[model samples]
Target: MAEPSLKRLQYFIALAEHGKFQLAADAVNISQPALSAELKRLEDFVGKPLFHRSPVTKLTAAGEALLPYAKSAVGAAHRFNEYAAAVNTGAPTSISIGTVATFLHRGLPQTITDFSAAHPDILVTTEEATSAAQSDMLLGHDIDIACGHMPLQHPGVICTPAARESFWLCAPTGSPITTIAEAVDSPFVIFRKSASPIYHDTVVGICRTHGFEPQIHHRTASWSAAVEMVAHGLGVSLVPSPVARNYHGDERLIFTRIGTRPNAPQAWITVRREDQSTLIGDLALGLVIASEALADPVAD
Candidate 1:
């Protein structure tokens, strides 16, 4: 037997919803006779009577059984049409983004603001995740794009450098610590390696390069928390310059340039290779451009 057309399924669903022939016809933008004929044809195709044809319209056993399936089919058809329309018009429908907490403070907020203004039709969703988690989310299709440090090199993932954020020495105000070497012996606050391996390694590598390992007295998951620890004299810490610049509390923390560790890690944007032509690509490109424009230059 031939399959039912989407028009027939739509008409059936409308009739089921309205329970009145005239209302159903109007809902489907068809004449009452035309709707009646189509519904009759549908019942014939199903090999059963669909409606009781009484003053109060009601579905028969077969009609009740087919109602849910017809609704699902019609809904799927409508979604397919919407998807096709969006594709033809080059309009983005939705974008799911994942980024590290540090990037959110760095330049991501402005990037999102600008991207939203530019593509208001696209619904944007953002989640804060670590680099590894973001990579996993991207690979699993949980998110369309990600921003974090050193994006993973997976078979269908493409990574691009978005911005560079320099690390700064955060110390309590009035402390004698002027450089990484000065804080070599001081208690150090470090990033939890599990949360941010790149940052942890960078801090450790910097300390090791200075002829001593950091006396790690405290560890935290976020730059803000590390800065807070420093402000409270818990320990000196290394923080990204952007985080320092954007920090809102505890003016007693001093952010100093680490001359020897001037090379900053490249913040990377990652996306699935297949999403390069979609709205995900547009969002990534816009974020990169916006981040570059808003990035603060390191002081000499």
Candidate 2:
């Protein structure tokens, strides 16, 4: 009989990890019947049953014995791929990044441009993700780096402060709002908590400090959308100073500096702690530091 293939071992590892045939199949991007058939072939090759088909899938004795070997094989294959990628100049090295939408408009574009110039052979891919989702993406290996607000508390993730800026009050151009406290009676357009919990809570907390809960008239998924809603006179909003700067020339909106507060939100770049030494991870860190140096913080 032919030896079991590496693909079969990968399928076995996925099935062992997930413990559900359908889920395992989905994880490996194959159909259920196909996965089942491949597992049967693997069993035949090994001359033992690997799993018991029950309400909860249970690995057979042989399956338990094979688990460690399968995991090692898959891990070795991944490391081999990474090694090949590192040495192969002909193939473009890929780095996947997750970042907030506001960063794309503010300073990230220039940062990407500068990085591209220095490492022309590197391929960069970006996904606009929320601060909450960026941590999960980094942990899952879906993204190599994340750029967003601080306070990522995952064990395997490390966050480095990239920049700091105060929140500004965004209101309609003709509004009489000179201070955040003055907007207490006005309806507010706030960012959805699910997108950036830190920013959302900061806005809410700042409002409460000024003596009232903001009357939220709209909740938007992105900072730009919240600002646009404020521009149309729908409501006022509290936005990061950098995001407000992006609308500096717009006639429909005005940005007001909030008085000195104890807790100003700091932007951060996050990566899997293990990846900090990798080429892509190091480059990402350098790029963020360079971009932050060029940004002028809002005057106190």
Candidate 3:
């Protein structure tokens, strides 16, 4: 029997992971019909029905038997590709990183600089992506490294906790919002809930704990934009303490203790557990080193 293509194998794994054609298509960056056609081709190669396409896609008995071997073949091919890349370069080279905006502005820049300095031979690149997108990209073998918030649970992706961050208040420099309660009447700029539900709810929870719901004046996707809005006197906003300290803003901004429990995203770094490259391990360690400074509390 003729062999199936690697592209088809990847689509097969994506479908198996996601369990829906549309979802799997998005994960693998292919059209749904295209993914379906590729899987059909794979099924034909084995001469058995692979998936029972119904209201819910499920593996037939034949597919159940083929799944493990398909995964093994795909994983072996991925390792060989990485090996080939290294061989062609004659040295360890080219690491692609996926990160969130928060970390891109936080400790990630420093970490990348340090890693690049120490391993000048390796070409490093970073793509800004949401934590959810990072998981998909990692599973698709697009990125060698991922850095984002914690509590991500994706099969075959290994996440390591790097550091914790505290939340702070960023008010207009001349505004009298010295406390969380003081901002009760002031308009607030918060993260849009659809973009980051945890962050949106936490910022709201902080205000509710202070005995008044925030009069939300604006919503933003990133803390960097929230801080900018606050600096321009658009609205008072809560910001992660590390970002408040590390992100340079002009005199228009003032960061203060909001007197609530730290409400920042816990930092995490992710890589495919299947990838056992030492270069990835060393780069992850560098991120850990850079995050150590963020662990120290920033005084109000």
Q: What residue runs in model 2 are displaced by over 4 Å at the alpha carbon?
A: 1-89, 261-264, 294-300
TM-score: model 1 vs. ground truth: 0.67
Across residues 121-190, which tens digit of lDDT does each residue of candidate 3 receive? 8888999887767766766566778887644685666777766566788888888878777777889999
Every candidate's CA RMSD: 13.0, 6.3, 5.8
Clashing pairs in 3: none
Best of the two (2, 3) by lDDT? 2
For candidate 3, the per-residue lDDT at 153 reads 81
Residue 174 error, candidate 3, Å: 1.7
How many Å off is the CA of 159 in candidate 3?
A: 1.5
C-alpha displacement of 124 in model 2, angstroms? 2.0
lDDT (tens digit, per residue) of candidate 2 on 1-300? 999888999899889889999999999999999999999999999999999988688899999877766765565466569659778746776778898876764467777777888888887789988787776566556677888875677666677777666678899999998788789899999978877677788889889988999999899888888988988889999887677778888999988877654355457788767778886677667757765774546455
User: Whole-model Cα lDDT per candidate?
Assistant: 0.78, 0.79, 0.77
Order the candidates by lDDT, highest first.
2, 1, 3
Instruction: Name the regions of candidate 3 deviating beyond 4 angstroms.
Output: 1-4, 10-38, 43-79, 88-92, 247-249, 263-265, 296-300
Give the candidate number with the greatest lDDT: 2
Q: Evaluate model 3: give its lDDT.
A: 0.77
